[model samples]
Target: MNPVSETQSQHDSAKDAFFMNIEDAYLTALKQNPVVENGRTRPQYCYYDGPLTDIVLHNFIQVPADNFSEFFSHNHLPIPELIAISHEGVVHFNEMPADIIDEIHQQRTQYKVVDYIHADSFFADPLLALNVAKQRNRIYCGHPTIDGLQICYYRGELPEHGIENLLHLELDQAIEFFVDTAYRLPTKIELPDELEDELKTSIRSGFETIVNEVKQQRRTLISQLLAQAKQVTPKFHDGEPLKIMLPSSRLTTVMQYCSRAVAKAFEKRGYQVWFYMEDGEMETNNLIKFYRNYIEFNPHVIFYVNQLNNLALNDKVTHISWWQDSMPQITEHKALRWRGNDYVFSISPVLDRHLALTGAKNIVRQHFAVDDEIFNTDGDIERQNKVVFVGSSYLNSVDLSRPEQREIVEIFIDKIDNGEIVTEAMAGEIAVRFGLPPAFVFWNLLHYAIRDYSVKWLCESTAMPVEIYGRYWEQDPDVAAHFNGELKHGTQVADVYRSARYALVSHPFEINSQRLAEAAACGCIPLVYDCRDVAEKPHWDDACLFFKTRWELLEILKTQVRPALSPTVIAERFTYTAAVDNFIKHSNIGELSQAKQSRISMFVGR
Candidate 1:
């Protein structure tokens, strides 16, 4: 090849490499931060403000503007448009567009026209607006100084300060907060004459609209809930297998053990039980695949163990579900997507009422039952003197750590302390506090209060010989000394229960834990809080000792307080077999069983 052509080829190759490097860097920055389709300040790559000469560049390699000679002079290509680290610890591509424009401008006489890049970039819109907002002191709750969602502060000194203190809030929550404080804002601080009527009226109108929508939504949700209250006649066919659906993954050891116990109980009762286990695995991700598989199995009934999804079911098949965890009041009140389950069961009585009030007609309250064969301890095993607590941490559980929990706890305490627990004034106060149209704070208040009480009671209660075992308790210094590490879920847990003389229980909700029943079978007594859900029953008083206060618990622990019911009696009362029997009886499966109707063939035609 000619010498001129060879040199031209090298320059062209260098240009391609530079552009490719720029593209790669721009794409990388986009992936590092969250993408908001219509956001003002989120990091992104888009249009340039002006031609190559107009914008100032930072932390970039300076290349001579008028030279292709410089590119050929170096052996390797210079990727000037790649990411540059700024002095202020920010990751950005500085003057990235200018290099691209310079390269394009060199090839073309006039400015290169690009249609897609239109007026948004690090240099053009978001950064400039942010700086302007900072100067004007208008950026409120989302100031850069704040870290995470917890701590936030507005930077500006305000003329009407008390009226518009922006707390760290979600988009919807900010709107609600504005309306909540709007009336009070007008009363305290005088606003500009032009801003007064317009802003206040706008907020009041929005508040009115939201109130109307909430009422409408409640009606709609209740109607949808009432639709789910269909009664299906039970067609219990003997020898037909009962199909059980479990999650495809993250099945805990305790769940697996409990599920096996239920399955074994069915087998013992002369009905065939089929688990969806295939190739030593029993799980599926697709709803269609599960449905088709269920159809093929042709089971008498289907039981979903805490599964919550919509799937088509065979008309004749009986469907029932069991939910173990509690959701917030708003979440529970909203219509749930279920696969036409005829009956719904909840472990917590708190949940049961929540479901009922929200329109679930056939709601049954149930509890976790133990398989005595697996959980049983040797009668002569020496019981340790320490009082053991085997469960997960309640106060710091994922459900309780949400943004709403703190507000809920504060409001509940305030109302109770004011001696307005059952008053209309308290209800109105709660509604305003939570931004609920009406007071739906009962479940949330009870659940969180109980959990907080449990934590406080444990820390302040008697200095009894105690050992705590659960995940995430190691961080808490109070629990740190007593923490005996996380207890393994299955029979190993039962052994721990057996070793301890008494198991301390303080469940926030009414959900009967397997540990309580297992402890009894292990010849360990259970000392539980006298919460309505846990100790409401007469039988519970007989089987387990109940305490209302820290002093009450301390008094009991001063001696080796044995339960009134014997281990055998407790085991007999709380076994999976007994649980299953109760379920079958309560569900009215036997009475509603399909019976054969007498039929005679007509011979007159023959």
Candidate 2:
């Protein structure tokens, strides 16, 4: 082989080895410094000593053209020439076209520039790297790498430390930091008056359109509900006895007992009556049974204790909702509207008047009645000299912390002190005027404030020992001493009334409380609170005793004798039979039956 050819081959081999060593050093450096991509860490090749990319300056502070390089260099950034200054303080480089510069400036806002960077790093727009450093208080810069521009974030805020102390962030992390920082800075541009007016006009037009659509939807819903209600045609039975349905489920014990007594009263009058019972569980099955029974029986009348039930929707049949309590005590405001063949029987005349004022149909002032069999003074019992009160103590249960509740109680107490009868209707009216809950006001007035105060006065003022048989009396240590222990309703309560010589009764609304009648039935003279309404009742003076003040009550206890009214006289008037007769007369149920019979006869004749 020739010596020249061999020397040339050896030189070429040495050059290849030198290049390989340089490549190995580059690869080693890349492995030591990694970059994060889509949450995965990989080696990145950083260019430390190479031709620098041209910096596109974002002059948010509007620094002078000549001072740009010097100002950036002081902050440890590379010096680059500024080719163009945008209308919005952005500097372009690398000889960009005039049209392209205009397009960038129009699309970009000072506040939204950071958002553009976050999205595809501004499509690698080159402005992001330098602009981010200039905007932040603490600027961090690293060698431009193949992975893209590296920005370090330390606990959200950049640290004023060396490069080694800085922490490298992922793409997502960098976006979050930039977005947070960008929002913190104030916006540099303001919209023109014309543009601002246009935006407001557009928003108002859209809002009005939405409101109209919603109103149309609400009207459509109401129309559908009314149509559905009209569609329900109840099945009527011909030539059969007029059936009555008494719903006895989901009621308080007193209501349940009253329902039973009413059912018996109807049965005694030669009308078929049925009690619908439910135990609360298996509601779906019970409802199915209820509907099935209702369809088969085809009742002429459905009686409810408190508020109107769903049966009111069946306009074909008569619905009698006998309210023993106040309207607000058992139902929401919407239930006040009674349409179709619905009858509302309120115990208190005040409540009946309120119902009439609200345009409620068939509003009857019905007094509560007692079952003569259960309440009569039949059993032989020793009578005691003490005055007895039977009811719950609501003072312990009332939440007086609420301003509205406390105010209601205070008002009721004031009325009682003034010898005024504050009825459930008055309480409900007060609740509406004050924007308070009606049920809350009524309950606190009757149970908590009035009753508690009355009982306290009766027990504390009288030298004679007073007996109280109810719950929560223990809450007041003074009242607890007079508490004779709890007594079960009906037979047990009747026995106590029979044993007592005088029954101390205090009612804020009417003198027609069932308790007063029950005490009278047991031959116990009722010592009631004196009110003008009491004088209005026939033979009220013969049946019970009345006092205006605690001092008057004390004087009565010491000197007054029991009334001359007999137990039989009280029994005949306040009995369930008499109540049912009164209900039929006032509610025009007899007239309804005659009308039905006339219609049937006319159809047969035709």
Clashing residue pairs in all predictions, respectively, total 0, 0
Candidate 2 residue pairs that clash:
none
Task: Give the C-alpha miss distance for residue 125 in model 1, angstroms.
Answer: 43
List the pairs of residues colliding in candidate 1: none
**Distance from true position, residue 149, model 1, in Å?**
32
TM-score versus the correct structure, for each prediction: 0.50, 0.55
Error of 1 at 8 (Å): 69
Per-residue lDDT of model 1, residues 1-606, tens digit only? 111232342233212112123334343333433323333333332222112221121111123334433331221222233223223533333334555546544543221122111111111222232221221121112212111111122222322222122222232443344332211111112122456677867655654565566446545544443333222222333344334443322224455566667777866775557654322211213233344454455555556555543334444555665656554532447765434435677776556765666566667766778878867877555777768887655444324455665676666555433432333345457667668544345434444454444444555546566777775566566666777776667667878888887787754334246667788778778877655433334346677876655566677777667777765456666787876676666653443332211111122234
Q: Mind sharing the TM-score for model 2?
A: 0.55
Candidate 2 C-alpha lDDT tens digits along 585-604? 87646876777678788878
Cα lDDT, model 2, residue 157? 29
Cα RMSD (Å) between model 2 and the true structure? 28.0
